[model samples]
Target: EAGVTQFPSHSVIEKGQTVTLRCDPISGHDNLYWYRRVMGKEIKFLLHFVKESKQDESGMPNNRFLAERTGGTYSTLKVQPAELEDSGVYFCASNYGQGRAFFGQGTRLTVV
Candidate 1:
């Protein structure tokens, strides 16, 4: 029963560069979700994946951002040509029908 894990903890890049974030959910869990909060804004949902299928991705901001969960295990989120506004804490959460979800420490992306 490993907890969700994220990579890099923090990243700083130029306005036009690209960055990729990773997430590893707990074992035996089928639900994985990506979320973030920017500049005092509320935590927003990015997408949801159940197993190898994407259950929902309507929260994705634009084409510049992409998310994938391969083999229903760990997931990845890539931001291409990043922007300053993209600077924020990216969190990955997982739930297995449990009332509470586990979250990673989060990756703080700082696009300058």
Candidate 2:
């Protein structure tokens, strides 16, 4: 089974710009979740997608952030008009019935 993969590994953008992060989960896994941990903050859930439907997205910080899962394959997270506080490490995880999950190395987004 293939593990989750994230692109770029690191990103630096100016304030008020946009950034898109991608995540490819293990094949056949129906559970994909997005999480992040900002400086001095614990890892926090951003959203979850089961198949093509978004199971939960209550953890999304604000309207500036958007997440989508098309065709139940891979997912993408976009932050529009990024802010300084948006700087953090974004992780994607996939679950396959087991309590353990596979995580990507994460994409570090820094807004200056």
Candidate 3:
């Protein structure tokens, strides 16, 4: 099966603009996840999905962000009114092993 896929690969936008990132998990895999790293901090978990339902979203930062998995085949993470602090690498990963899995080439978001 194909591995996780992320689009754009990188993005640069001014503050207050909106950006959406996409991720497509491997076929037949029901587990997907999102993660991000800001500046030099350790990468942090953003959310997880199982089929079409979000299994865990405790890692979500705030209301300015939204994540959804339509039909459980692909997922999207939107950051509206992007902030300078939001500049970082966003990663998508998925697999059925119930642990750490394959990761897509992250989308690097730079806010000016």
Clash number for every model?
Answer: 0, 0, 0
Candidate 1 residue-wise lDDT, 1-112, digit = tens? 6688999899999999999999999887889999998979999999999887889999999999999888999999999989888999999999887547889999999998
lDDT of each: 0.91, 0.93, 0.92
Report the CA-based lDDT of candidate 3 relative to the real structure: 0.92
In order of appearance, the predictions have TM-scores of 0.95, 0.95, 0.95
**lDDT tens readout by residue for model 2, 1-112:** 5679998799999999999999999888888999999999999999999887899999999999999999999999999989999999999998866557889989999999
lDDT of 3 by residue, 1-112 (tens): 6789998799999999999999998887889999999988999999999988989999999988999999999999999989999999999999875756899989999999
What is the descending lDDT order? 2, 3, 1
For candidate 1, the per-residue lDDT at 76 reads 94
Candidate achieving the largest lDDT: 2
Clashes of 1: 0
